[model samples]
Target: MTSDQYIIQRKVNIVELGATLGNISDACRKLGVSRQHYYDIKQALIEDGIEGLLEKSRRSPRIGNRVAPEIEQRVLDYALEFPTHGQTRVANELKRKGVILSAGGIRSIWLRHSIEKKSLRLKRLERWAAENTNVLTEAQVQALETAKEEKEAHGEIETHHPGFLLGQDTYYVGYIKGVGKIYQQTGIDTFSNVGFAKLYNDKTALTAADFLNDKVLPFFDGFGLSLLRTLTDRGTEYCGKPENHPYQLFMHLNDIEHTKTKVRHPQTNGCTEKLNQTIQEEFYAVSFRKTLYTSLEQLQTDLDAFMDRYNRERTNQGRHCRGRTPMETFIDGIELYQKLVHKGELMH
Candidate 1:
């Protein structure tokens, strides 16, 4: 029984003992309670029944800064639409719509729902997409496939060092009137959050191999590190027979192992998905409106500059980066990579 029930039962025993003894003083002394305490308990029971015996809590009943239900609902609804967004970004976007909640307040709401982390919020969005796929927009559908918390608390995330596993993906960066249909090939080191991207007019095995040959390998080579394994979704550009397919052939030539995500679950390569979203929101969305691009090279040039800054300047809050730039994390991890390589434990 609960403590309250035990307390009430003991008080009732005191009352019964007094009757059996026919001496209030003797019964009170045996039970270690004063007669006055006994009378108070009896009176409380008579007046309000057993519920009166429950101990009163010392803390306040409600949180002082809890937002109203309607306000909390707005934050939750916004999370569904923008699962990749952090608390500050979420608050800023909400403020644009005239809602005046602070980032801390929005975070408090997220904590209550177990979605304070981007992965947790994405996990929730993943569930929503499963149940409402028919009505989801293009972006929402992408978000669903983009990230899932591989947490034991929620999903399982493997700890990796630099050059361990790089996640790669292709994103259709919307259509431009004069530039034709644009696509981006993206890569991210799962350990350090270091990212790379290149834009092209076509999605093909040629571009996929070119991304690794040109952008990815050179950077790692500069650091004396080797690119080990790559993770990607099952796109035609990534998966094919090693005999003639340019992308598969490239992997075979480089001695790099290839890994593919589950058939429909793109979130397994969440690092690249996250990088794609970052470039989409922080770069392309703003750039497309500010200038008129006449050729693919113009957009590609701007994309390269932004990615340089992202690697060297943008501080990340990921588990490994922890407020440092991706380049910093990448540099720090090189020592660990070398140690593992020397021990002959770096192989898949």
Candidate 2:
């Protein structure tokens, strides 16, 4: 029988006995139920009729002590502050800063704030990087062949300076947890072969543009004193979706021209292409160790620190550098650049 039916029957038996037989204990014994159970049924029947004996409301008590909005915002703020970091990493950071919370709680805060899992972007980038990898167009093939022929005829390929020419490409460091091991968009200065990278979660026109505006452009205007050219591949990062790809607009605004390497032959942009691979070997490989990163913000911080050290302190084997760091070379080049400027030969 339903609990409500059973409760009603028991209460009826108790009442019938109390009125006719005058003993609730005797009535409960006759009904094969305890005295306490009978009394409980009696109370429920009087207060709630049949419904009280049924399941009561299962809702939880209102959590007036829920996490504060500002606390959750703090979690999001810290996560953005360290882009390469994941929710778990952010949780640790919060803990380190003495914010007492469970990892799951911190993750919930991230979710509530619409902070997506970093791995999602990494996976998308990995797929795109794989799809576009080494698949050169017919035009690119012909260009490679032409460049090879010219090199054979002249012994050295004609190249140009930073703003005059930039070479763009991608490099890989093993699989990342969220994003598989795919290509990270990279660039090099044709003049000095100095390198930089835009570690994309995936390549979108806007992401590429943002990378250029927020990261690459600043580097050019600052550290790369002689930058006058930007070389790139005709990848979507540069060409397709002009509305989203800010590099085109940026180049137009600065009055700088972007040159693309021959379609299939990255060797035409060999300087930056080579440096992309070198960065994979010299920095990413060492730092990432082929494991998935927990956070992009953390990774960016590490990359920035490494780059600064590389430019200011690390010794290079290239003849152009004479074992000096890129920063040291840049400092020396300033004097030469001023001389060229005085002679009306060089322009910023």
Q: Which candidate is the best by TM-score?
A: 1
lDDT by residue (tens digit), candidate 1, 49-143: 88876666857636656788888999999887666667876776677578898889889899989999876876686567557653434443443
What's each prediction's TM-score?
0.58, 0.48
Tell how far residue 246 is off in model 2, in angstroms.
3.1
Q: Please give the distance, in angstroms, between residue 140's alpha carbon in candidate 2 and its true position after superposition.
A: 35
In order, candidate lDDTs are 0.79, 0.57
Candidate 1 C-alpha error for residue 194, in Å: 0.6
RMSD of 2: 21.1
Which RMSD does model 1 reach against the true structure? 10.5
Top of the candidates by lDDT: 1
* Residue pairs in clash, model 1: 150-155, 150-156, 151-154, 151-155, 151-156, 152-155
